[model samples]
Target: MRRLRQLAERTPAGRERYVDLLRALAIVMVVLGHWGITVIGYDRAGRPTGHSALGDLPWAWPLTWVAQVMPVFFLVGGYANAASLTARRSRGGDATGWLIDRSARLVRPTTALLVVLVVGAAVAHLRGADPTEIRTVVWFATIPLWFLVAYLVVVPLTPPMYALHRRFGLVVPLVLVGLVALGDLGRILGPAGLATGNYLFGWLAVHQLGFAWYDARSPTNPPRRRLPTSRRTGAVLLAVGLVVLVLLTVVGPYPVAMLNVPGARLDNAAPPSLALLAVATAQLGLILLLQAPARRWLRRSGPWQAVIAVNSVVLTVFLWHLTAAVLLIGLLDALGVLPTPRVGSAAWWAWRVPWLLALAVVLAALVAVFGPIEARTRRHGDTTARGRRRTALAVAGYAGVVAGLLLNSLTRKAAPEPLGLPTPALLAYLAGAGVLRLLRSGWGSRG
Candidate 1:
């Protein structure tokens, strides 16, 4: 607490603390929302079995309007990336080296988590636990990796994406939206898997909104230019978003749920749709309207310190929270203390109280254990430009890391009876981590 206060006090006066606040808030919501909707019970074999409540209960769909908060994260991502890239360029670093630096921060901590999970998988298999069941839990445990994969995809594009943002302004996102709609149409009418392109388009559009916020908060942007987050604009966004959201989900084909519900025909999030973008607009509006007050509140020492503390290891908390929850669930199930109530019943809702509490306790412990790994990864300066051979290694390193993360993000339906990542993908990820570590070192760069 004392260290956090000192760190908070030392913050640059010009820093946009609210963006940090929004990021911390988004992670909290994602964790809690996942905990609440998780439907769980011990099977007849006394093994744990569960899935998203959105699968078992339709009424829970409306809660997604509040629970789905990734848009805010991406928006904040855009703003932060814009700031970071600006700072990097100001320091004379190229995008590739800067990207390598960025990738290491995320990838290093991720490597720790994957190592633990892989070990756990092997242990379970050795203990005669069903490989299929072990893989099921592993898949759930690694769900957060998909977002990491998606974020990694965009992080490298930040330089170019910010370029487009600076040159074209709002038109960039408008065009991206057109692409998102096209992707959605392809999903419906074209060949299978074509619409997956929106995974990048839809999120990139939201990230672009952050670029707008970066400019929105900048004093250098001309005052004569229309402010992106003005109250009037927020109102318009909120109104249009609500109307379009209703039209798409109610009158149009998209499902009401914002997140992917298992067994659903279409997921607004998996391959984001027009509906998800509408949600982003409304979310962005509320973010705009709330921006000032949020900044004001965050200015206080106590609040700013808290946000700082969370942001310091937010990735660790995110990476390990589900694993912690699943572990606790298993423990409680083995102890015969875990409850199994009817889905959507009053008791089930009440059960979330203890469930969340237990998960929190476990998650806090796990964070304490794993967060230092992330802290050690906190980088300040960007990597200097390296030669051609180094660039090739960096490219291969990044490709392998993202590819491995994506491979592990598969569902049972996608890779039937999957029992952990394929050996080659795991090897790629491990080899990639080794290569990246070498690139980070001056000694390795010389050769």
Candidate 2:
């Protein structure tokens, strides 16, 4: 805490401290929302299972608009990624090197989670745990991977997509919106899975908007950028976003909930509908509207320190919080202490208070366990190799990691389920890493 305070005090001048605050806020909301909604139950034979409260509480649909914070992360990612790319290029860093730097932080931590999940599943299988129970647990644990996989699909595109952002400005996101509209149309029409394409287009739109936010205060923009101008822009965005949202949900084919409710035919969140993009626009506007004052508030050492503390372990918290929740569910169930009040009952709401507290403690312990691995994933000063070989290795390596995540997630499937420890995905990922290591080693030639 003391060190973070000192670090906060030494924060570089002209830094956009509010971005960190927004990210931290988003992480908090995600953790709290997930923990609160997650409810675990046991089958008649004592097998554990899990589900969301959103399924039972139809009245709570509108509340999800504020809770669905994924767009905020992408928004911040855009600003931060843009800043990083600009800075790296300024320092003579190419896209290949930049990709390597970015991938290390994300992939290393993700690898740790996958390794642990595979090992845990293996141990359960060796002990003769029921296949149904194991699959349920694995599915619950890998929920975070859904977002992670989607983000991975987009992360590699930062360089090229960012180039489009620079070349076309706001037109990039506008085009993405058109793409999302097309996707939404396909989703609503015959083949619903066609909307899955929006996972990239939708998030890319929010991310591209982040670039717009960054551009407002960019070095290229006027230094004397007036507050009223940005605020006016924000207001227009807010108005347009709300109008579109109403049209999509009320007048069009989307659902009211911003989240992907279980078993819903039209999931606004899973593939991300235009309605969700509407929500993102509103959230982005709210972010822009609040940025100036938020930065001013973040000037306080106390608030800034908290933001730093959370951001430091943000990935760890996100990765393991659900795991912690799952463990607690089993433990509390065994001890006959896990609450099972009716879904929307007053007693159920009462149980959430203690349930969340317990989950937080477990999550804190998990973060403490895994946070150091994340801390150690820092950028080395080693220069990357340049050439076609370098680009090929980096791209292949990144694709391997993504394939590995997707394959590991497949273990969560029913019917022809994987027995344990997703070996193929693990090998694929290892092979990818080997190629990346070869890339780093200059492809058997000196850099």
**Against the unseen true structure, what C-alpha lDDT does each candidate score?**
0.82, 0.79
Off by over 4 Å in 2: 219-229, 410-412, 415-421, 437-447
Candidate 2 per-residue lDDT over residues 264-381, each given as its tens digit: 7788887878899999888877877887788788888888898988888888888888889889988977888877777788988899898888889998888888888887676644
Using Cα atoms with residue i matched to residue i, what is each candidate's TM-score against the true structure? 0.94, 0.93
Per-candidate count of clashing residue pairs (backbone under 3 Å) = 0, 0
lDDT minimum window of 10 residues, candidate 1: 410-419
* Candidate 1, 1-447: lDDT as tens digits: 889989998999989898899999999999998888888876687677877888888887877877899988999999899888888788887666776677767887899898898888788777887777777788888889888888888887888898888878878889999999988888778864768889999999999888888887677875432246788888888888989999999899889999989888898998778999999998887877887788889889998999999998899888998999879888887778878888888999889898899899999999898898887775546544457776778778888888887766654522433345566668878988788877777424543
Report lDDT (Cα) of residue 222, candidate 2: 38
Off by over 4 Å in 1: 43-46, 219-227, 380-383, 411-419, 443-447
